[model samples]
Target: MNNEEAARARVVSTADRLFYAQGVQAVGMDAVRSASGVSLKRIYALYPSKDDLVLAVLRHRTEQWNTGLAKAVAAAGTPRDKMLAVFDFLAEWFREDDFRGCAFINFFGELGGGNSKVAAAVREQKTSFQRHVAGLVRDAGGPGHLAPQLALLAEGAQTTAAITRDPGTAAQARAAAETLIRCAFE
Candidate 1:
């Protein structure tokens, strides 16, 4: 990557970890600067304001998650397997030592329905993720309308696992999804 791109990436990567682990409101500019090893001036140059940086971090995370999910689905051999892969992916993610709640959801929780641009970006990112998952469900030959419900179940499961520290929630979600898919196809 070019120098500028590399610097911006450093900022985003650091900010992503901080923002995800701590609420957006809790993390400060100085923390980002220190974590990234970049000057405050450089951070400001890249992102004029904390809100801008927050939005950038959110976008970066959204891209990373979408790419990961897409790869997971693609690697699965069958449509049902692809659908099950979503839950498997979440189960694995929750097992990570640094795993926090969903970034978008966390951001939304932090903002608490503010009228900020970052809030809008978080909402958009969530909608986009749901749509992406929905598309995968459609490709798996499930009814077109089943995508939203499946997405909800998957997201609900993620939240439950994160909150309850129960990985079994993911397994149960996968089994339930398989049953739904079978019913839809039959």
Candidate 2:
């Protein structure tokens, strides 16, 4: 990759790490520079502003959510298993030492009210995730209402896991999901 791309990635990764660990509002560009080793000048040149950096971080998160879910679903053998794989992915994420719930949810709580772009990005990520769940439900021949129900379970699981510091929330959500799926298909 080129210098600019490399620098941008460094800034985004560092910022994302710092932001996730310590809310977006708490971390400054200077903090990011210190963590990332990218000069503030280059950071601003790449992101233009803290808002821009925040957006880049959100985009990176979006990619991670999409890719992780895709790989998890791809690993499952059946359509229903693919649906359950979503929870499996969450379980893995929750087990990580750095787990801090959903970045979109966290960032939205932090900046969504004051920032239009951040708010919109959070909304789009949520909407896209819901659509992804709906598609999985469709593929599994689940009843239509199951999509929202399942999505709620996952969302609630993420919040609960973060609050309770329990990775088993994913398993619980997966069980609830399995029940929902059975009720829908049976």
Candidate 3:
């Protein structure tokens, strides 16, 4: 890549790690500059403002997550397996020592509304995910409501596992999801 692209990437990467670890509000421009080894002028030039930078980071992370989830689902053999893959994915993620929580959820928590662009982007990403899973359920001939139910369970599992640091909660959540899927199919 060119120097400009590389420099911008460094800034985003640094911001991504810091924002994920400390939070968006807690991490300032100077911290990002120091961590990225990029000048404040360059950072501002690339992003225009901190809010813009935060939105970029959120969009990048959201795309990364959706790509990972799509891969996990595609790798599974059956529709049921694909559906269950969400839990498996979360379970493995939660096992990581640095896994704080879902970045989008955490971003919203930190910002607490007011940024219309970020809020809209987050809502669009979430709705896309829900529709993706819902499409899978529809294809599997499960009940119409099955997708949202499983999505709620999956979301709850992520929150609970993050909060409690209990892997068992994920397993229980997976089991609950399985039961729901089976019931829907029956």
Highest TM-score against the true fold, candidate:
2
Mark the regions of model 3 whose C-alpha exceeds 4 Å error after superposition: none
Candidate 2 lDDT over residue span 98-121, tens digit each = 999999999999999999999999
- Compared with the true structure, what per-residue lDDT tens digits does model 3 show for residues 53-104? 9988887888788888888888889888989988887787888898887787
Per-residue lDDT of candidate 1, residues 1-186 (tens digit): 899999999999999988887778889999999999999999999999988888898889888888888888888998878888888888788788877668777787777488477678877887887787777777787888778777888889878877988778878888888888888889
Better of 1 and 2 by lDDT: 2
Q: Residue 136 in candidate 3 has what lDDT?
A: 81
Ranking by lDDT: 2, 3, 1
Q: Candidate 1 at 97: error in angstroms? A: 0.8
**Cα deviation in Å at residue 34, candidate 1?**
1.4
What shift in Å separates residue 86 of candidate 2 from its native position after superposition?
A: 0.4
What are the Cα lDDT values of the candidates?
Answer: 0.84, 0.95, 0.86
Among residues 3 or more apart in sequence or in different chains, the pairs in candidate 3 whose N, CA or C atoms overlap within 3 Å are: none
In model 1, which runs have C-alpha deviations exceeding 4 angstroms?
none
* Alpha carbon deviation, residue 18, candidate 2 (Å): 0.2
